[model samples]
Target: MNRSAAPLVRELQPGEIGPAAAGLVLDALAARRDPVIGVATGSSPSPLYAALSASGADFSRAAWFALDEYVGLPAGHPQSYAEVLRREIIEPLGLDPQAVHLPDPHREDLQKACDEYERSIAAAGGIDLQILGIGRNGHLAFNEPGGALDSRTRVEILTEDTRRANQRFFDSLDSVPTRCLTQGLGTILDAGQLLLIARGQDKAEALRAALRGPVSPECPASVLQLHGRLTVLADPAAASLL
Candidate 1:
């Protein structure tokens, strides 16, 4: 994907991104039965999920996959991606809990678990649409800067920047896990479409780098430039730099 030619950007008002994103997924569902969707955690996509739930969209037939999960956190932890999705997405949207999937950060054989996850995505016919949020450092999922762009689903050490950014979710900075299991860039690129959402001025610089900067590993999200179809929805503050 050419950096200049890929990723169609849309700058919308504060409350517009959520409904816009929901409409895109609903449209996809209309075109295909049981569409597989990739979900993300964080403030950026929270409104999107809420809008989806409020729209009375039928998610009973859809398959859900999370972008990543923190390692070492016990099951049912409030901060765990699985539990977060369950509370914020699945239950609200009335999605079949059985069809929702997330990486097992606690699996003994983590490599095997990652392999199985990749296989499961393939078995589900790949993700029809993927929702994503860019870290302050421009990481996608847990594919931190300086990591291989072609990486697959696997464990990764959280960068200091990432850990600090996520500290708000924990009791303290030290309480934040140093590692996580994330779908790699290669995995994310497999999605039929990528929908990246952002809000607030804090995200402006990162958003600018991700959407207008060079396609280098230092800015992992820049790899989205290689995607066949990409859509970015951002509030005025987040799109300010652009």
Candidate 2:
């Protein structure tokens, strides 16, 4: 990573990260009439969602967009991002389900679906703030290692590490979808601000590599260095190497 352009990193207790992140979102919403936000799923953001939900923040006018979706999961599958966001973020925050959007990985024409997703983001005035979680392998969204840094919304093969990491959500490793539709680095960078959350010692090395190592596709999260407004909030374990 380029140290000069690295994100402003903050080390906070696990319980504090959620309120801090929710504050950012609430502030953004207050500053704009209808701010658009991009959201990510996984363990890292659970606390943040909880805080937002409990804060009584108004999200009625916010437009929500998801980072990615598994390619083959059923529409209402309990593990699908849609279902996950509904339970974790949307319903809790009292967001209008009609205002939330996600990529359609199950569509027959996935490429077109990706294109439409991109267009929808642009039409909504782009994302004001994008919440993210870095994978252990340093992947951003589902743009795995070696993916183009300037890629757009598209289909990608999930890495073995990604599959294994997500296995906790499924009955078996084989149950995880091998492919996904994800917003590319270019799409994520388009946001006015980026907020990334990570916790646990398992993410320590990846967080270090992303913030202090050379910027490279091999560690996709490293691209955040090029983003002008990026904030990384992590607990001690995840911030250890930084």
Candidate 3:
């Protein structure tokens, strides 16, 4: 593990990922009141969601926000971040959906909506823990590498690698929108703590570079290495080079 250059690089044994994330959540809850947390979408967090569901913790006081959303996808879409979260965490936990907020996918005034989203986040108090899933291209959230780190909540053109990775979620690549709205690195970093979760060989190289490589927009997650409390959790294959 490249401990010297990155945050803590934790190689967790199989079947341990969910508990780890839940533990982190509990830790955060113990650390502060009504903690603000950032969530990520997709399969990587399924275990985390399950673990959380089993925790029996009271989160009525917690505030939730997510990392990104696909532009043009209806909020009602099964694949939409909002619905995915509602299925995985909200309804099951009986969380107050009104307290949980995510970027709206169907907004006609996208940038303004993002601006308001950012404002709401800031007003609710900055995020306490921001969970993330990296892109095959080293992008964090949807802030594709090579994009400005100082960016805020805004629209982004989905990169080819990102589109390919998400193709399975859609009927076909042609159906995927070319644009998305994601919380930028700067916006994400505002969170007091961050957790980047990676698993499987598909993310091995990207994981290695994020921990050992240079800090650059060329590898957006690399910037997390600069944060005081960023944590990278992965299985052995994802931790191949450290």
Among these predictions, the greatest lDDT belongs to 2
Q: Estimate each model's TM-score.
A: 0.97, 0.97, 0.95
Q: Show model 3 residue runs off by greater than 4 Å.
A: 1-5
Can you write out model 3's per-residue Cα lDDT over 56-93, one digit (the tens) per residue?
Answer: 98988889998988887765888777888899989877
Ranking by TM-score: 2, 1, 3
- Two-way lDDT contest, 1 vs 3, winner: 1
**lDDT of each structure?**
0.89, 0.92, 0.84
Candidate 2, run of 10 with poorest lDDT: 1-10
Clashing pairs in 2: 1-213, 1-214
Q: What is the lDDT of residue 121 in candidate 1?
A: 94
Q: Which candidate would rank higher by TM-score, 1 or 3? A: 1
Task: State residue 117's C-alpha deviation in candidate 1, in Å.
Answer: 0.4
Ranked candidates, highest lDDT first = 2, 1, 3
Candidate 2 lDDT, tens digit per residue, 211-235?
A: 8888899999988988989999999
What are the clashing pairs of model 1?
Answer: none
- Give RMSD to native, each candidate: 1.2, 1.4, 2.4
